[model samples]
Target: MPALTKILIANRGEIACRIQRTAQALGYRTVAVFSDADADALHVQMADQSVRIGPAAVQQSYLNIPAIIEAARRTGVDAIHPGYGFLSENADFARACQDAGITFIGPSADAIELMGSKRLSKLAMIDAGVPCIQGYQGAEQDDATLSREAQRIGYPLMIKASAGGGGRGMRLVHEPGDLLEQIRTARSEALNGFGSDELILEQALIEPRHVEVQLFGDQHGNLIYLGERDCSIQRRHQKVVEEAPCPVMTESLRQAMGEAALKAGRAVNYVGVGTVEFLLDARGQFYFLEMNTRLQVEHPVTELITGLDLVAWQLNIAEGQVLPLRQDQVQLNGHAMEVRLYAEDPTQVFLPQTGRIDTWQPALGVRIDHGLLEGTTVSPFYDPMLGKLIAHGATREEARRKLLRAVQDTVLLGVRSNQRLLAGLLQHPSFISGQFSTAFISQHFAEHPCLHPHVPCAEELAIAAALFYQARAQAYRQPLAGWRNNASVPLHFNLGLDEQQWSVALDAVPGGAYRIQVADRSLALQVIDCDGRWATLEIDGVRQRHAYHLHAGQLSLFTRPGSLVIEDRTQALVSGQASVSCGTLKAPMDGAIVDVLVTQGSKVSKGQLLVVLEAMKMEHPLKAGIDGVLKRLQVRVGDQVKNRQVLLEVE
Candidate 1:
């Protein structure tokens, strides 16, 4: 292949920017392709040139092969890099790049085709003497065959999409009764997400550690492993935290796993970067899962420990260069950990969030890979992961502490996120001791305080009240700060948050201090300084600073518990209107309606499945909140709906 001078990144968001950074550093001009929604995205601005591929939808944009190739052709680029996600693991995409005379900076299309399917990859691994779980990977994909096979495999088996990864198109069936339903759902999801509904079954390993070995190979028949990462910290089968050098890995175990991973790579003549995932049980036995045929989202941890840039290595390998280092020469340095910062609401079952980012303050002394500006709008057209926070240290404890502080200090306001949950998990005893598995979140975080809805405390309310008062005083340019016509009377204000209201009274004291009362608690507050966003306050004699953003009567404050949004409703009119009936069902977020389980005039129970909305590449089933007859249905199976739009009405 000719030297790669100008490369076109056929993706968007952080990964695109990440690849561009590395490519530009290596004297390679980079081109970016984006959808209509991402025309003003950070990645587009960072690239040397950009092309509009298609509209906001993935099928018409990022996943549109012809459009991506045409963009590359139009830009006169020499190579095309499909950064993870959209078409990263797509074999046809790789082949198209190869056919278009554009070097595909990845493994061979044959390798991608072989390993993209869980079923096919497992069969090859078994034939190559690699350890694999006992299950069914047959060609008969009929529901009856899958059900019978499930019976033979016993209860507690995993239904996995052959052409899927990233936790999609997968389900765990704990009983025989739910096998068929899970298989159907998994197949449907797999079909929609991967264009193939083929599935495989395997015995679910209980309390197993999710470990993966990073492998790199070249066309010169050389392959090596760059250690392993423990991705056991996950939720809904998606990884939340990843770290390099498995915590419990012994020298022998590492060697065994690495050799097995190399063997899997060699089976398909893999080149460039790939990962072999496995399930490491408590007994030191590991079984092959599937192989990811591109740079992983968790690759930063490996790069930090190995002291090598994987993307640069990928570029060199794509240029037909030999492996940068041999298996024995590979050295694993200190410790490194990374956490995925997602745009989600922990209190609302981790639902993906979308809105304009009002404030973007990344933590110092860490590596943050994200494509976000202060005013960037996070749309619902893609994944919810905003970026990653990575920390490297001489020890695991150091890395953990640094990551915990980063999670707390990095402020992202104007939208809900899982910041508190990430902080809690980082400091939790189980995580601190490195004693965790893939079941960590599901087993322990269900009722954890960090995941619960936060009700603002008296101190927080007082701080918000003070900020609100200061904003009003500034708005009116009060001649005398906190001055009142009636000196003996106090100022009353009402604040609202999360549908709850609080009435607070503030009494202006001498020397620019105020005594605030919320419910039964009273505190003395002195605003040392206020700049509209950051404020220094002496509350009850405790001097500290806090971050806040006030816009249109809504004050977003960063407190000890988490980010809170308090609305100043003191001047709002009091309405006697009744609340909307519980029978009304609305779309939780912007998404396409994929399934309508009930028709108009159908009798539905309180918990009956009403609709399945597909958003952020996941399916969410909307259930009826009250028992009633379905009086109206306003959406069909392929209708795109907006957030809070009424989907149905039950009378």
Candidate 2:
């Protein structure tokens, strides 16, 4: 077969750019398909050729099989690389590519179909002599049979969507009473996420480590496992951090798990890159979870350890080539850890944050796979993940330390992210000592929160933000008002941060210096250096250089703790209307109202669920923060709302 000369990436954001980079290096022309929302995306700009797929909605664009296949045909590409998510594991898309005489850079349609469904995959594993958790995979879809199966499986069971992964259609029920409701939710989410409502029941393993083996196969029927990744660090069933060479993995355990992974591949005559996930319990017994039939999101850690380009291998395999490396030929190297930087607020229950990234500065001495630019607008239509940071070192401790520094040095302004949270996790004693389970975040961080909270730099940021704004204002004025020979007056400003407001005063000192006072905390600051988007200041005799960005009346000050955004309320304060507070609850972000749990005029207690907002493919339920009567319900199910739009009023 001829080699894949031109390829079309039927995905967007970082994955698209990632595929383009590898394809270009291998002497292949690349084409990128993008939605309306991603017209100015980084991936689109990096590709050799581009095509407009459809609207911002995923169904009309990335997941639109017909459109993607047509784009490949139009570009005259030989193969289509569905870079994970979207249509990557969709058997129909792969089959479509094959029917169109275009290569799909992944496993065969038969392999994907067999492994895509958890129910069928479990049965397949059982037939192949793979140890699987005791659960129900029968075809009975009735609630009575499922409930009976749940009873037989006992309490503390898991309900999962048969059609997909990514924690979308999965839920845990610890009690018999909650099983039915959870099953309903899981089915709804499953059908919406994967177009299938088929459910599967599994015995929930208590605190088992989530380990997966990365394997590759070719048409020659040779399969080899590169290594394993410890994906035990998760939150809300989504993996936040992953590492290669699991801390608890011994030589024997590795060999056993690796063999099982190879057995899984051989069972399906698997080809191309795939991941076989397993749950390793405290006693070292591993049980099959499922198989992912495409390149995984955490593939970088494996790549770093094996020093092999999995994407290059995928291309070669698609060209009907033999396996590049044998089992013995693969050598494990040093340690590597990856942290996903999401556009979210860890403090706010991980609610997705969206806005333009005014300042984008990634740290040095690490590998950053991202699609962010200075003016990148993070829309609510896509995933909240901004990028990923991978750090490699000779030792696990060294890798952890380097990753913590990398997270600290990184500066992403204008949107809230989990940078500080990731830093905190790396410094936690449990993480540092390598003694953690899948429940690490829940047991230590989620309920308790902030294992090592960054010291509060709010006061410093407030003062610096004021000074930066004042400097910008004066720089564009005649004679530079603040630089006058006899500067005697002070500039008064009001800044708002969430519920707290700061009354700040800045007095221009002699020689272009300033004395800033924010609610009695005075700081003697000098502008050591500054540019359009950054500033270096000497505050109270301590020198610190930082990046700052001002856009749409909001100022972002990049500090060691993280980016601090302060809203300029000076005008509102002067107008005497800023101090007013309303009892209306607004939509936290732009999303579709999925469910209205309460009716108008219904009384609600504190923490009572009110409405569910779906954005970035996740559901966030809005609850009442105060006990009151829900006097008005402003939204209904399926209603699309904008950020800060009033969803309800409580009184």
Candidate 3:
């Protein structure tokens, strides 16, 4: 254990940048490992030095242990910090670093291996009096065996991966008939995501609040719990929003959870920063989930609440320094919340999206940790998380309010994202009151998705749309052809950006108003004010200001950048077929073909899996729409595909 001079970060994205800032603050030189896609990434430029790990695909780059180790070796780094994902919990990587006489900057290989398996960790917890919800974690994992265990647990249960940590390796079963399939899906996802199908069972902890306590340990046998974080605001088990000092927690419950977390950490002799997750029910009872041996994605919430630099602690602990503070000295400050700004389409069930953040600015008084800043590309090969927008306030309500404002002001225009939805969720009554659960997204949700409650043709979006097309048409005419010394010609254009398909259309008219076609009722739009990129107008004769942006050569009227793509009709492709043909399979959008699940001529059933596409660090399973023999596999593993390009054919 010594004062480290150089530390190499073994991951990319904002987390790597976050780790670097802390390490640099402590006077340590930092090196960054980046893939080709991240060559121009902010982290690469921020680090003292950077090395090319491999290609953009995570498997060959960030997740490749040898490449990361080599990056460390080449940089002459004293320690390698696996900043969360790629190999954060990898025991072999830890051992290799140890063998090479370099510190892993995380827990020992034994600690990682012990907690790597849920069954083993649960056993250790149970022995140490850590109460876990009743579920099976034995060796028997067949379909029937898992079914019996699920039934024994209850009608509502959860299937968890033994080695899974993220929301990836888990499934929820609400009915007995759906248990096996859920288990299979969970196991399959676990295998695909973590390279392990080994799973366990647990009580789903119905409608319980998701809470986790942060634990810090050092080699000197000292451990402290840094209170808790309420990551209940989640989608697809992935956290969309998180906050500190859960409003739902009673003082008594907090102490109890904190003590339980310490016991779990001490039992495994955990080192560095880790989080012990728990499911807190309405009645305030809590149950053990698992321990994350690395920094959590939502660690910013903890840092804000405790006002401590966790990355510095990781470095110090790895260098064999005893913790400077004791558990009794820990204090929780004002409320803080973190919203994950992802390149995703919130209007389309939170799908991962990739594009540029053309206008990147968070509201004032908010701490923005952006990975893909303005002019940065949101690549399809990595996690869609562009940055974390965190806000701290005197109270949770104030924090939530500030976070909503931050989201509203962000203006991410390149690809779709849940910016508007995030704003809506932050202001949601249930969310504000802190009444949330895992089923929050799919349950009691809106049947219709609209950026704003009302879409006025005479609004700012309408004006921007008309102006953009008018500008394009003007450019086509002449540099001074449309130069109106007489009068400004009333521009006319049509817009067909019907997001839900059941919605209406618009035929643009002069002076920036439009004739609307929603259902059988056609309305008139009157333009009131035009502000270049924004407009103010009347829908049915009511005026309201709205957000608008010009991106991808089209005028998008305040739409989520993640899901919906607004195409200028003048540039849209016209297909001869009324419907896409039977045999052809096209990609939903532009993304890398991460995995070719089915080969050419592979027989498949309707909805059977074909390829696993990874875009924006999220995995998408492309299923067969019709029962047929596959033909003309257009993509190979690691090939990048685009929107509407035929990925395969079923004859």
Best by lDDT: 1
Q: What lDDT does each candidate get?
A: 0.90, 0.85, 0.77
Higher-TM-score candidate of 1 and 2: 1
Over 284-341, each residue of candidate 2 has an lDDT whose tens digit, in order, gives 9999999999998889999998899999999999999998788889999999999999
| Residue pairs clashing, model 1 | none
Pairs in steric clash, model 2: none
TM per prediction:
0.89, 0.88, 0.80
Model 2: CA > 4 A from native: 447-459, 465-469, 472-480, 483-489, 574-651
Candidate 1 on 1-651: residue-level lDDT in tens?
667799999888889999999999999999999899999999999999999999999999999999999999999999988989889988999999989998999999999999988899899999998999989999999989999999999879999999887778899999999988898899899999788999999998998999999999998999999999999999878999999888998999999999999899989998999999999999999999989999999999999999999999988988888887888899999899999999998887787889888888888998999999888899999999999999999999999999888999998888788889999999889999999999998888889987777888998999988888887776765476556789788888899886579999998766668899999999999999899878999999999988889999999998743589899999987642212235678787899999988899999987678889999998888887678899999999999999889899997
- State, as a TM-score between 0 and 1, how close model 3 is to the true structure: 0.80
Q: Is candidate 2 or candidate 3 better by lDDT?
A: 2
Error in Å for residue 363 of model 2: 0.8
**lDDT against true structure, model 1:** 0.90
Residue range 454-502, candidate 3, lDDT tens digits: 2433333344444454455456555554344443333334444532112
lDDT of 3: 0.77
Q: State the weakest 10-residue window (summed lDDT) of model 2.
A: 573-582
Best by TM-score: 1
